[model samples]
Target: MRVALMITCFNDALFPDTGKAVLTVLRRLGVEVDFPAAQACCAQPMVNTGYLDEAVPVVRNFVRAFEGYDAIVAPSGSCAGSIRHQHGLVARRSGDAGLATAVARLAPRSYEFSEFLVDVLGVEDVGASFPHRVTFHPTCHSLRMLGVGDRPQRLLRKVHGLQLVDLPAAGECCGFGGTFAVKNADTSIAMGADKARRVLETGAEVLVAGDNSCLMHIGGILSRQRAGVRVMHLAEVLASHEGAA
Candidate 1:
């Protein structure tokens, strides 16, 4: 299948290697993946921040940019969730029937990384090796919104030499809801601290998550506390070899 990588705005700027890792893994698995440079934000930020009116153009641009792919895969659950769940709302909020129709035609085809790997590609072992003790964090959108379930864990378990550990209360939110952190700093930090504590308790060298935004949120607390846990994207872990992660 011809797939396009919807590198979310957050990933494009902050976690570039995450995108590269996704590309590497997909290509290695013999999937034709491409990135439409014209693609930008999925408008998740604006919509999540109570700006549906402002998110209309962004939603439009997202649909327009990644228009022709058979599948649009994003390494981020939050962004993929935005496209699947919010685009219709934004189109309706804008009172654009044409846009709404276009979105309905496209949104279902967009999948998060784990969803694509498990549900679409139908393969868990991508011939990857990462000999490290690792724990995974199920981000809010992937867990609650997209309902990705244990697809990520299923894939991670098949990786050679990787010890997958259970995260304490793995379903809990990391509290990095885009603007939620900024609007409620104390609560965000508290939530992040709790997550970091749980991650440290796993005694894993790496703390992995489907969304970099959550990793970024929890990583900060882990870093400040000198938790000695490396934060990584699931794609990075899947793409890791003896050379790079």
Candidate 2:
């Protein structure tokens, strides 16, 4: 199967390690993944920020870059959800039937990392070993947009020496809704504090979430409080092995 990695722009700029970790985990699974140099932002920022027209070229670039891949795997549920749910809207708004058709064809083929692992690859354990007490925060897009319920948790359960703790109100949004954090700074910080409190309540060494955007927001709060808690992307945790620096 031809699989491509749609490393979203946020990851590319801020959390390049997450993208590398995704490659690590997929390669370890014997999945020969392709990284299309032509790939760019999934246009979620424009669409979510009320700039659908500006998003057309980005969406166009997205479908073109990942057109022929049998599956496009994105490490982010936010970007994957944008591709699956929002791309069609942008296409239709452009009044381009061809674009709409292209989006419909490619969107369904796009899968979030956990969805690809648990649903497509059908493997819970990817031979990962992380001896850490970790608590997972289900990002909003992953939980609500993609309906990736328990799939991430199921995979976490199988990691060797990993203790998966239940985060209080795991479904609540961390207020890192992309631009939402920037536009509504006060409310965003309040919500992030609440989420950070929950993470601390778990008393876990690390806070894990599929989307690094959310992790960054909460991690900032944790760092300011000197919480001494590390934030890691889910892919980073999964890519971890028994012995490697």
Candidate 3:
């Protein structure tokens, strides 16, 4: 199976480690994944911000870069959801039947990391061993957009020595909705503060979520409060092995 990693622009820039961790976990699981250099943003930002006309080139580039891969795996549900649910809209808006056809062919092949692991790979335990108290926050896109219910939790539960605590209001948005945070700073901070409070209530040493964008927002709040809590990508936690500190 030809599998490609669609490292979103957010991770490619701000959280490169998250992309690396995704490679680590997938490679450890015996999945030989490829990183197509031509890949770029999934055009989610433009689509979500009501700039579908402007997102045409990006969506076009996405399909071209990832074309022919049996599967395109993304660590972020936000990007994956965009590809699956939004790319088609952008293609149609461009009035390019060829682009529409391309989007139709490639979008369904995209898979969020957790969905790929639990659904496609059909493995719960990837032989990871992280001895830490971790709480997982289900990102809005992962939970609602992709319907990735309990898949992430199921994988976390199998990590040896890892204690997966239930995050209060796990389904609530962390207010890191890409441009939503920028356009609505006050509302975003308020929601992030609420999420930080919930993370602290778990008393977990680390906060884990599939999307680092959400983590960055909540982590910023925790950092300001000196919460001493670490934020890690779900891939990073899954990539952890015994005695590798």
Off by over 4 Å in 2: 243-245
Lowest summed lDDT over 10 consecutive residues: which window, candidate 3? 236-245
Q: How accurate is candidate 1 locally (lDDT)?
A: 0.91
Which of the predicted structures, 1 or 3, would earn the higher lDDT when compared with the native? 3
CA lDDT of each candidate?
Answer: 0.91, 0.94, 0.93
What TM-score number comes out for model 1?
A: 0.97
| lDDT per residue (tens digit) for residues 36-80 in model 1 | 988998988888878899999898898788877889999989989
* Span of 10 residues, lowest total lDDT, candidate 1: 236-245
- The TM-scores, one per candidate, come to 0.97, 0.98, 0.98
Which residue pairs collide, candidate 1? Answer: none
Superposed by TM-score, candidate 3 places the C-alpha of residue 11 at a distance from the truth, in angstroms, of: 0.7
Give candidate 3 misplaced runs (Cα > 4 Å). Answer: 242-245
Query: Which digits, one per residue and each the tens of the lDDT, describe model 2 over residues 146-222?
Result: 99999999999999999999999999999888888889999999999999999999999999999989899999999
- Candidate 2 at residue 29, lDDT? 91
What lDDT would candidate 2 get against the real structure?
Answer: 0.94
Of 2 and 3, the candidate ahead on lDDT is 2
